[model samples]
Target: MSPHDLGRIYRSEIEEQPAALERLLEHDAEIASIAAALQSRGPRLIRMVGHGSSDNAASYGVYAFGLLPHWTAMRDSITLTVHYDSPLDLSNSVAIGLSQSGRTPDVVEYLVRARRSGAFTIAITNDPASDLASAAEATIPLEAGSEQAVAATKTYTNTLAALVLLAAHLAGEGARIADGVRRAAEQMAESIPAFARDAEALALPFSYTGRMFVIGRGVEFATAREIALKLLETCRVAAEPLTATDLAHGPVAALDPLFPVWAIASPDATLPAVQEAAQRIRETGATVVASGTAAGAVQGVQYTLPVPAPDEPLLSPLLSVVPGQLFAGALARVRGLDPDAPHGLSKVTLAL
Candidate 1:
């Protein structure tokens, strides 16, 4: 197969991200109305909930929204709906549920409860016909299209983009976000090929590194987790992700001379702490690779992803996770694992 064909499955998915954003923007008026209603109500709290890649998006959303003054954002559907059965303050709350397919039972159930409890609910999903979307007060469609590969690629990026857009909307910065989205889409279009090339080259070495660790701070921490999940699901490799501070607590002991570590070191307030953690991990004699926009922050092989503009810093997770997805997909191919069908996983989880 030709190189173009070999990577076409992932490349196409990556390239379509911009178009997906365009679709979202084209529907901006409807989305903006929803945002206005939600913001006008002035929710006391904001909750983002999902599973798998969607969960990762929720995690990122929490970080992005928390940066706003007096905003209470969290990822707690599982804990609240399943474990504690706690009654949330829905009278002044907005519940955002994310799902690529909008079919997850837990997500659907939680959103239903949230809505019935009087909270404004929004569904971020690719499938407009899905149950989750039907239950939501408003649906922000993720135009990622149908992803053939079980491991999500475009959907993950689109979800993060949607969440960030939602954040900007809620914060009453719709016009600014629209501008950023356009710029980000253009930058992403230019960057996908470079990302593919860089990730392909890195995958050759990654295949041999049986075990790996991903570390990041702040929103990048969620990026690390998403990367770890992608690697584990698609590459069928044992990968772990930890927060920079959490790594120092106990996980650091697992680091050794033979391990390989990947750090998502974006330019943020936590960059210093992440840089220190990367340095400490390097001291363990592990080969390290750092990916970020900043120059020379990392000591080893560094892949600097192009950033469109200095984003809300809280929204960096949307851009940071793209490289990780590419790396995971490429590494899976390098390891002779089927990117479409890893060991034993389905495209959709239907546990009714």
Candidate 2:
């Protein structure tokens, strides 16, 4: 509880996740209004755009938008939209811009272009007056307050929840979505202490690991990517994010019995495929650590690091990442690195 703790800022933000999610739920009406407006537009796809943690948040939206009563979604090419200014037809599309500070020039520029191209643009941000919010037609506030950590924690989770709610509204699953959010908040609060123990133990193994792969499938794929990025930024680990299919395709060759491989196996449609991939990776003699509620179900993995189960399958990416965030912060502290102030980085960067 000392302020002098190395990763205190990052830890505090991670610990505030439940309250941040609660703030999001408080804005349900606003989110619903925007979702209704978007539905009226009859958009066929959601084009998500952001950079850094925000970009990873967009990946969650991709999964959210694809949930049953399915809708297509894709990441907008920031280079094409911002730098090259390529003319794109977006009349039948919805574009969502995500930013913590809401000041990233490239993200703002892309939102501007998407709006001009006839897309119903929306910005999810912590700062209401931020440039990205101004550029979009509507805004979803993250309500994460001020995050002093160099690495994003609260904002990422809050933004993910907002995207999920938006998706649920679009799919006409209002009541279920509200219940799911409440359950998710409770789980997040309870998981903190349990996962803290797991993270503390896992840090010892990761401290000695030179490189690793973080794998997930479906919505959890984006969860893996965010975890890998945190490990890389905070712990200085050469962590690569890959999907189960990608590992099976060719990357499987790199793992050895001594090699470190982390798998996120949640309870979802992709579980069988991801577990199958985890079993195969374990056969390669690599040290496989399976994470998620179904960690015990993934036979052959050397470690089963269980996290709190998600309330809804579509919310897997948001809940499954809790343990990974704890692991990254703890692992960085174990490695004598300052997780809150990682080198060669800032809280925000202007891609343009």
**Which structure among the candidates has the greatest lDDT?**
2
* Pairs that clash in candidate 1: none
Candidate 2 residue lDDT tens string, 164-208: 888888888866886798788888898898888989898887687
Model 2 Cα shift for residue 139 (angstroms): 0.4
Q: Give stretches of model 2 more than 4 Å off.
A: 1-4
lDDT of 1: 0.77
Q: Give the TM-score of candidate 1.
A: 0.92
* Most accurate candidate by TM-score: 2
The local distance difference test score of each candidate is: 0.77, 0.86
Estimate the overall C-alpha local distance difference test score of candidate 2.
0.86
Lowest lDDT 10-residue stretch of candidate 1: 301-310
